[model samples]
Target: MSDAVAAPVLTIDGPSGSGKGTISRAVAAHLGWHYLDSGALYRAVGVAAGWNDIDLADPAALVRCTFDTRVGFRDAPGGEPRVLINDVDATDELRTETAGAAASAIAAIPEVRAALKERQRAFRQAPGLVADGRDMGTVIFPDARWKVFLTASAEERAERRYKQLMDKGVSVTLAGLLREILARDARDANRPVAPLRPAEDAVRIDTTGMGIDDVVARVLALIDG
Candidate 1:
């Protein structure tokens, strides 16, 4: 097993719609480093179990399914991340509200997190790794060279989510989206395994009013410095 000290990692962690995903991807692209969307891994597990009719509450069953399953990410031309589960293109399937909620639930389980820990860490390679997820900084990549916690107001996040879904042709009301976002945030922050929080040394960026380019530029400066 490789020690955290052996490789450099940049972790960007925060709640949904805080632009962590987009920022992390851009950072990885700018730095020519690898990227890991850790949340997608849990979502893939939830999706696989759902397809097989396995009960998510069953820890033993989830552990078996988590290990037996294989998940991978592929960049699409212009869209959200594509998730491939067990060789099948489940890009669209894994993005639904159901999958996201299921992922949050499963991620709370100790055994499930234990199963995916090494897989997430293995993304650290020669150049570096930019990891994005709720716990990337708090847990998975605690020793990261640079850790950032990107966040925005709940209302702002909901609006962002609403626009994203609408742009993707998914019909969703703003109020409904707001409620869901709040609920998920509460759950994620209260989970026992790796509750969402900024690492002690993490730089917190409130992207509520910042432009993407500005945020990227600021993050780049931090990385360079």
Candidate 2:
């Protein structure tokens, strides 16, 4: 395989709780393509910085940390994929609300985004790639053959997140989760660097009332067409 050739990519961009992650994984699996969870990269960075007691507000420091960090993703024995930071399994650590908030804060830094750009793009391989992120279609894979923007109402998203957390035995209030979701949405959509907006050529899917299978089927039809 020639290293110079860019692999075709299917970009799935959306905010949190939009089912983009699950849908992207399904699409990648169906097409036998590599998958890139770009948000997990940021979350891993945030987790690593927290482990080292680094301040997120320091853009220069965060950028340096991003380059110095080594993030890996691999399937766990009986669960979802695991995230590794410097060989340490931080899969669970990176999913905390704290880490997510920290990630959002640092992702606003242009330097941090630039540092992770190539790393995220490297997942594209011979077969193809399915990239899921807030800006995958808008920035990371603008030339992607397929671009989708998934979304859901804030209330629905909050309920989904609350249920997810509760299932894992995490103590969190639905109202609080809703507030945080709204706050994160505001920050993500208003950020100056690659704000969370659908690409012009991207298809928008509101997953508020759709099941996973339904969403997947719709996306597959688009790809087939």
Worst 10 residues of 1 by lDDT: 1-10
All candidates: TM-score? 0.95, 0.96
Q: Which candidate is the best by TM-score?
A: 2
Query: Which pairs clash inside model 2?
Result: none
Q: List the global CA lDDT of all models.
A: 0.88, 0.89
User: How well is each residue in 1-225 modelled by candidate 1, as lDDT tens digits?
Assistant: 454447689899999889988888888888988889998899999999999999988999999999999998777866556788999999787778889889999999999999999999888886788899999888887778899899999999999888888988999999998899899999999988799988999999999988888888878888899
- Backbone clashes in candidate 1 total 0
Which residue runs does candidate 2 get wrong by more than 4 Å?
1-6, 77-79
Report the lDDT tens digits of candidate 2 across residue range 21-65: 889988888888888999999998898888888889888888888
Cα lDDT for residue 70, candidate 1 = 98
Q: Which residue pairs in model 1 clash with each other?
A: none
